[model samples]
Target: MEIYVTIKGKVEPDKMAEFNGLFDLMVAGKTGAALETYGEDTFPAAESTLEKVLDKFEAAYDSINLESYTLEQGKLTLNFMGSYALEQILPDLQVWLLACGVKDVELEGNWV
Candidate 1:
């Protein structure tokens, strides 16, 4: 089974830059670039915030893989794919995103 999950939200204004760097790290194959781009001082905290959400998925739902993402104008949309049922993952993901300072979190899932 192929399940697709789309998450939409806004990163708080002050957090957008670091979030963008994180997005680049995740989606653009730019590992460790966020640390350089965001500076060592700011990047660790920013990376930790992103890590909390990823660690949840990794620890509890290892099947899902974040396939892509876009962060622009304070809005973020993350696309994920996996074999797991969407309902099993969405609620915790929504909460994790909220905890990471993403506002107005919304999610949708479909199977293909």
Candidate 2:
């Protein structure tokens, strides 16, 4: 089975790199080390581990005035879908919007 998790948000262009980097790191491996390396002020301490990451991610989405986030958890895999408006604050932010149309699907849900 597979679970899906989606996050949506509007962010400045310059911040897209940071956001995508941190998000990728989280999906790749939501570990303390990973958070410490990619996390920013919005990211919580890694002490709580994946729980903290999820909490922080949720908060971040809320802060960005996101449209919605959907999470589906299954027996074997997890999928994420996110949708948000495009911010014109910076040109770089468009990078993150590349996945706006489709959901991000990760094969495993180690945190779950």
Candidate 3:
């Protein structure tokens, strides 16, 4: 099945630098300090942690495919084909996003 997982959220302007720091680092293809090692609560391990987390999910769930990933200030959308349910993905994502300074995290999905 193909699924669209849409995440709606906000990150306070003051926190934008925190979120952007990680995003920008990843977008620039750089490595950052691990979340556990970093003093800041925000997850800076963008390249490693994010993909590692997703890899863990993919390993546990067969037939999981990631099609698209999109992120912006107020919205995030992930498209994929998967046998696993949204429950398997959303909670961890919610936690990580919040730690990354994303507020009001919400998830919705459609399958086809």
Write model 2 residue lDDT over 7-97, tens digit each, in one string. 2344455444555555555465553555555443443333234344344445555212222232223111213433331122112222223
Across 30-107, the per-residue lDDT of candidate 1 in tens digits comes to 434343444345544344544544455556555336689888788899997766544466776676567657889887
The CA lDDT at 64 in model 1 is 39
lDDT of 3 by residue, 2-107 (tens): 4566666776666656655544544343433443333144655443445555565656764234454456664544444454554476676566676666777777
RMSD of each: 4.5, 13.7, 5.9
**If the candidates were sorted by their lDDT against the true structure, best first, what order would they fall in?**
1, 3, 2
Stretches off by above 4 angstroms in model 3 are 17-52, 61-87
Alpha-carbon deviation at 58 in model 2, angstroms: 16
Clashing pairs in 1: none
Error of 3 at 2 (Å): 1.6
lDDT of each: 0.65, 0.36, 0.54
Cα shift from native, residue 4, model 1 (Å)? 0.6
